[model samples]
Target: MSSSSAPTSGTLTYDQAGVNYDLIDPLKVSAQRAAAATASHLASHGFTEVAASRGESAYVVDVGPFYIASIVECLGSKALVADEMATLTGRSWYDGIAQDTIAMAVNDLITVGATPLVVQAYWAAGGSDWFGDAQRAQSLVAGWKKACEVCNVAWGGGETPALAGIVEGGRIDLAASCTGLINPKERLSVGDRLQAGDAIVLLDSSGIHANGLSLARKLVERLPEGWLTEIDPVNHPGLTYGAALLAPTVLYSPVTEALWQAGIVPHYCANITGHGWRKLLRHPATLTYRIHTVPPVTPVLAFIQQHAQQDDREAYSTLNMGAGFALFMAPEDAQRTVEIAQGLGIGARIAGQVEAGPKQLLIEPLGIRFGDDDLQLR
Candidate 1:
């Protein structure tokens, strides 16, 4: 867990750690505008783009009888924590990284009311011998396939390229792409039915899933033992910081599938990832998202908050804060959604309801409000 890097400042910010959304957001906006222009190109191929899906988590295209949703997501820098852990613990955590890759992709795809059909992996290594470690390679493959099977998706073949100049030695970057199906079309939950009366159902997260690892890793440099530092003993027992952060992301596909089986189609579904709870305002409607509750913060995240000195606003705006997915549906389906999630061994509850105001998210418990300007995903 030791490194040559200097100890970081006591107080840290995500932008200071090198990922500045302000600089990166405009690029995303420009890319979206450019990609939107290419939508008409799909029409000639016997498919038409779902206009509302343009700025959504996944891309949905209609091909006459059925619709297909696609998403490509990376594991981000979380793999770096696993690399450090392997050095200290002598155990490879790539299996969890593999699961995180699948969770990142399919979670986005299911939000478009699509059932994941197949997933393709992308493993790019800096050195040719990155996969020479037989155990790590086998664990990655086993985890990826198991995640796909749990999501009821097939493991589509993928590519592994060794890029000399593109990547760094002893490091492997992980990402995946998933294609899903929305058959009969009525199950789509792209916010088309979202309205003021809809209730918001929130699902619990498995601590620090997939987002904010850059900031977390940077915080490691500030710690005395880096990743080896044991986190909150009460919450994590004897687990080190690296082990806690590497906990695999929870896959939300099964929850969505359960909703479909019970005929409870959410008006809109959001996979709470990089944008945090601000993603509740991701829909294009002019409605306001009024959240009456904030789920209990996980201790691992609490440790980060205390260590990083982030305020409620800063913490809620950046991390999942125990809430992972948000579902907007008619008020009658609110309790039912929670039941479905609980039946599937997931924690969930009716968090709030929508309002007729302008597009915004109001967290009543914390008195924090995020206007449309706050969430600029498009």
Candidate 2:
């Protein structure tokens, strides 16, 4: 057998790798317009007390000692995969995707140092498939309830739509809106407290943690039949490699609560979603996040690397690479942070440290450095 070579189409870009630029562009434009309109409205209404504001996937309203934050997220292409998985495993359709739907919203809030309070999901189903439809709706509610319970959040209820023509058999679109509260004094901001000598804490991820699936599916489609039939060599688990890839995303409430109790405020916290560590460097000044030690390579990630012919750097940049959350803290508080996370039964480790100038990420011993190209979003 011969080895496969990397795609030679000129430094494979993210959009070329299957991220839908056309679909995302309109949404981006609309978001910008909406943000401007909202700001104008607020100003016109004489709401001048608001301290700061920025718009992206969510909006934040500053109110005195605390800030009210909201996030909205939809079940991307993974909804189709979830349907397939459910049919294959004889599980409820919504059962597999509901947790991720909630996590997507709650985690976004957490990245801004907000504590999630209430979660609401909106779902639309179709056809006369009452059995599947009812099961999916019920499973979604149960899943959200379970997630909220674990996160110490409350279920604020939501809307369910039954559209016969708009949705097809076994088809559903799920989305969520979450509200959170954060003390302005305690809110973590980029570059405010982050500095050189600050240690980085990495919280272990359960699996892919709900990003990069479009590329993952493309790669899987090109693979030979029964590629994931065998058990993974690393972390030998009973499930097939593909099955393990479906592991649910890790919830951060426990870790956040632990840090809150320990009074170990992070200088910066990143959810490590879609863009990985790139999201962590959204600060003003030049900064470098040196990841020295990483969580042990899980079987799923190892399989992806080997099969996709991707290097460690590409894998880490594209996926969570085993760490779900990256927290920047003072060197003195590193041990305490790890202890608190561990005490809460969450896997935590010292992944790296911050440094001055040369705004680039370096992986020690390996001598691998990632620059703007590697971290930049297309």
Candidate 3:
């Protein structure tokens, strides 16, 4: 593994990398408020929007007998890493990037307790020449189909636009929209049932899982070999930084589906993405999430932490660390939730419980606390 000198002064931050939620979140809050105003318009179509789900991961609407949830999510800059990795390794990593795109959409969709039914892709290339590479194009298509099959959703077709000047040449932006069903009108989980005693079950993540990539990409500049820097010399002998970053995100829809099939309904579910552990405070309810344990950090993430010189608070606030998805449910169902996740070959554990207090998340092990001010998505 190549080595880089420690930062001369301040630690690197996500904001320094040009991804600042402080500036971005107020816009989301403003949009949500504006979006709520248009909900009443649904009445004309004989459907009622679930006002409570306005700020949830997926937007839900009641159409009499059943509820529908939908979300559109983008893959962010992770695809750029795959692009660089392809150049370094001489192998197309777009297949994993394709799955990462689908995972981003469906994971958010399932947090509303909706079973994903279909996914639509949006591939906007900088130029038509982008698709002239048959190998990369085919890998992307195959991966998208494979991910849809894994999530048990149909590939409902999509649009591929070639924007020459708008997007940088030789690059493509990937995103997807997922539509889901909340049948029987009982599976809707928008934190309405979240309370003091609900247990917090955390599922393990497969490395970074597509969040904080901008910062990760920025960190590459400090390294001598850049993307080719080996993440770890002993354990992961030949694993390049690019390979680790390109690891496909874990698709979590199956865990949600399996829990529902087993008759367990989480009070609230959060797909721990961009907000990192701070997402635990996403619910609107005024409650304290006390986490007793945290999943072990993925090796690649540890490498980033050491190189980036991020403290526990900074790291947990910006990246997933290890937990990918979180579930707040009845205390009695905590073990069952973990079992269900494990059954599906996902690592999970009862990490904490909710408490009646201020809106905050207290990670006990690291003595890290994220207050309501940390996240303002609502």
The C-alpha TM-scores of every prediction are 0.96, 0.86, 0.96
- How does candidate 1 score on lDDT? 0.87
Kindly report which residue pairs in candidate 3 clash with one another.
Answer: none
lDDT tens readout by residue for model 2, 1-378: 013333532233344456666788788777766666666555664443232335323456655567677788876656766665666667664555788888888877776677889988777776546445566668867777888887888888887777788877667777889998776547644346789989999888877767876655555554554335544644474555456666767788678767877787787777778865565554444788788887876667666666666676677677777788888889888989898888877789998999986778887745667775554331
Q: Which stretches in model 1 have alpha-carbon errors above 4 Å?
A: 1-10
Deviation (Å) of 76 in candidate 1: 0.7
**Candidate 1 residues 1-378, lDDT tens each?**
223343355567666667656778788888988999999999789789999998888999999888989989988988898898999998788889999999999989999899999999999998789989998898898888889878999998898999878888989889999998997699877878988999999999988999989878878877787788889877567888889999899999999998988988889999999868888888888998888977888777888888888887888888999998999999999998999999988899899999899888999999998898978776
Give the Cα-based TM-score of candidate 1 against the true structure: 0.96
Per-residue alpha-carbon lDDT of candidate 3 for residues 163-226, written as tens digits (9 for 90 to 100) = 9999789999999999999986899998789889999999999989989998888888887889
Q: What lDDT score is found at residue 153 in candidate 1?
A: 90
Clashes of each: 0, 0, 0
Ranking by lDDT: 3, 1, 2
Q: What is candidate 3's local distance difference test score?
A: 0.90
- Name the best candidate (by lDDT): 3
RMSD of each: 2.1, 4.3, 2.9
Worst 10 residues of 1 by lDDT: 1-10
